[model samples]
Target: MSVHSLNRLIELREREVERLNVEVANKRAVGDRYRRSLERMTALCEGSGASAALPPALSLNCGNYKQAMLGMVDLHRQDLALHEADMAVSQRALDAAARKQEVFQQLLARRQAQLLREHESREQKRQDELATQVWWRGQR
Candidate 1:
């Protein structure tokens, strides 16, 4: 493949990797927030009041709160599962992109080597021409 095409592919692959990284970070953040919220609910229900275990207001909305808290916990589980699945897929894509990047690097190195050899060949031809001219000038 041409160096220009290879370079463009590399650039695209790098952008994809970066985008995936950001996506993974966002998924993790959402998962963490849900987990923390669940923890907070648990802590609040089990209160810090040494004698009264439940928060004063906690009893007022007992049945509704229990159902709501159960719903929240269920939603949290679903959210966690969704994020985990996303993370797995993203990791696989990133790994594939990394492999492609490695291959592109190798191809670039090979192309550079070929160009370097071509440049040296051209430089040698120029030097030989200069030397021939100098020898002819001396004879003249």
Candidate 2:
């Protein structure tokens, strides 16, 4: 393929890599949010334990609330686990995209270098031919 086409292909690959990078970053941000939420929920549950100072009715209510919060926390943990699994898959895809882009970049570099050498060779040959013609004229 021509150098222009190769360059275009490389550009497309670069865009793909960039897009994957964004996706990975977004996934990581979501994971961070989940972790923060889990931490907050755990702290709330820990701090909400029933105390002797509270009236019996209040104590019972607090216990129930804590139980409900614990259940919610468990659900959140499962959701976080699933999100992490999805993130792992996305990371793998990003890695693959980066590798593919690298390959295309290398190929483009090689092609450009080859074209440059071919151009220089042709220019040198023409110069040599011109010099030969001048020399022949001088000889005459």
Q: Which one wins on TM-score?
A: 2
What do the candidate models score in CA lDDT, each in turn? Answer: 0.80, 0.89
The global Cα lDDT (0 to 1) of model 1 is: 0.80
Per-residue error (Å), model 2, residue 43? 1.0
Runs of candidate 1 with Cα error greater than 4 angstroms are 48-64, 125-140
Count of backbone collisions in candidate 2:
0
- Candidate 2 lDDT over 1-140, as tens digits, reads 77788778878888988988899899999999999999999999899865566999998888888888889999999999999999899899889888887888788889889989999999999999999999999999
Q: Estimate each model's TM-score.
A: 0.71, 0.88
lDDT of 2 at 76: 94
Clashing residue pairs in candidate 2, if any? none
- In the range 76-115, model 1's lDDT, one tens digit per residue, is 7787788788888988988898788888988988998898
Cα displacement (Å) at residue 62, model 2: 2.3
